[model samples]
Structures are given as structure tokens and as C-alpha cells.
Target: MADNASGDTAGDALPRERKPSNTALAKQRAHIENLMQNVDKPIELPQPGSKKPLLKPPPEIVLNVRGSSAGAGSSDFHTYRELRRKEHLRIKLMEAEAAEDAIGEEFNREREALKRQDEEKTAKNRAKRQKRNKAKQSAKKSKPAEKAALPVADE
Candidate 1:
């Protein structure tokens, strides 16, 4: 074990610390503070404009039609029954599509109504605030004038 000037050996030196660098620690703290500040922002309720999925075709039903069970090329194929089933499915699909369209129309109408209602509410609140402010200003103006108009005391 060779020592330059002190008696301590090379192996006796303490291991270098592996703590995060100062810049990295400061960046981490800044990120945490940003997250905390963002969390404090008021949460808005999901609007009706958000996605409401329309009807979707079933996977199994779609898979069944892709096979050779409909055409008559195969000896085991059944044509009439498949035709009838396809017709029934088509009719059912039309009906469902129509119903969904109607429902979507209704939802649109309801959204318009809610929007109108909110607008009216905001207008009413603005008018109320303006009226209150005017009243307060008029009251303040009249008070000082009234005090000034009062006759001086006899003393």
C-alpha cells in the first residue's frame, strides 16, 4: 500500500457519493411544483360534445358472413335460409340505424337548448351586476351631496 504524504492507503479512501447532480435535483423539484400547480386548476365537467359512439357492427356476426355458408358452390351450403337470414339482418340493421339517427337528432336538439339556457343565464347575471354597480355609484354620489347640503350647526 503506497501513500504519497499521508499515512492513509488508496483503498481507505471513501467511495464517491452517487447522489443526483444539483441540476437534475433542481429540475425534478421544478417538475413536481408544476404538477402540483396544474392539479389546482378547476376541473371542468365533461361536455355533451364529447364523443358518444354510434352503433357498431358486432364482430362475430361479421365473421360468420365471411365464410362460404351463404353461396351454393359448396354442397353443404344453404341458399334460401341464408337469403332469408340476410334479409332479416338487413332490415334489422336499417331499423337500428334509423333509430340511432333519430336519437342523435334529439341529442343535438337538447344540446342547443342547454346552450341557450346557459347564454340566457349569463345575460341575466350581467344585467344584475350592471344594475347593482349603477345603484352603488348613485348612492355614493347622493350621500356626500346630502351631507354637504345640511345646514351648519348652531354652535
Candidate 2:
């Protein structure tokens, strides 16, 4: 039993064998080179009068200040710049107005809620005051009769 246990421990402690670093690196380099070769190869042209080729469409042309003026045959640089600046300012102004309107609507809703809460509190206080006043009036009526009887006794 001891011999079998020692052999099992030795087997468990043994290191696993791995491939050499140079061979592993060489295999990776070969795979990358194969990918590079395929990437540079041109696509075959489709035959005429058959199915159309599935090529990507050309990119859209973007017009900046120089491109726009040149395309439009206009020579004034400062006027173009001014027009672009005005368009940006107009967009910013519109965004600011929209933000202000949204904020105002939220504030109005909060204010109305607070106003309703205050009205409810005032109504409760008014009911309590009316109850106290009724109690005081009943007590006063009973006290005056007692006072009138006491004065006759004293005379």
C-alpha cells in the first residue's frame, strides 16, 4: 500500500510536456503570412451579360467650406464662413429654447403639486378650528347660567 501511494504522488507531481517556444512562434508566423497573402489577392471580375458583381458602392462626397465654394463657383471666403457660423448659432439657439421649455414644464408640475399639498393642509386646519369653536360656545352657555344662580344666593 505504501509503495502504491508513493507512485501515485510522484505521477501527480510530474510536469506536463509542452511544445518548444520557437516551433510555436514559427507556426503562428506561417498562419499570419498565409492570411496576408490572401488579403492582397484581387477579386475576380464577373462575366459580362451574366449576374452583376456584388461590389461595395463608392463613398459619398463631403463638401466643406473650400469644396463648397469651389463647386459653386463662388470666390468669397469670408461670406461662406459667416453663413456657416450663423447656421451653427441658429441650431444652438433652437436647442437652448427647447431645453428651457422642458425645464419650465417640469418646474410648473412640481409647483402645482406643492400648491395642492398646501391647500389640503389648510383645509384640515380649518376643520380643526371649527370643532374647537363649537366646544367653547357650549361651555360658555352652561357657565353663564351657573353664575346667575350664584349671584341670587349671595344677595
The best candidate in terms of TM-score: 1
lDDT of 2: 0.75
Clashes of each: 0, 0
lDDT of 2 by residue, 38-154 (tens): 997866677677433233333266354465435554545666787667667666766877898999999999999999999999999999999999999988998988888785556
Mark the regions of model 1 whose C-alpha exceeds 4 Å error after superposition. 1-77, 153-155
Residue 25, model 2: Cα distance from true site in angstroms? 82
Q: What RMSD, rounded to one decimal, does every model reach? A: 12.4, 21.9
Residue pairs with colliding backbones in model 2 are none
RMSD of 1: 12.4
Model 1 TM-score relative to the real fold: 0.44
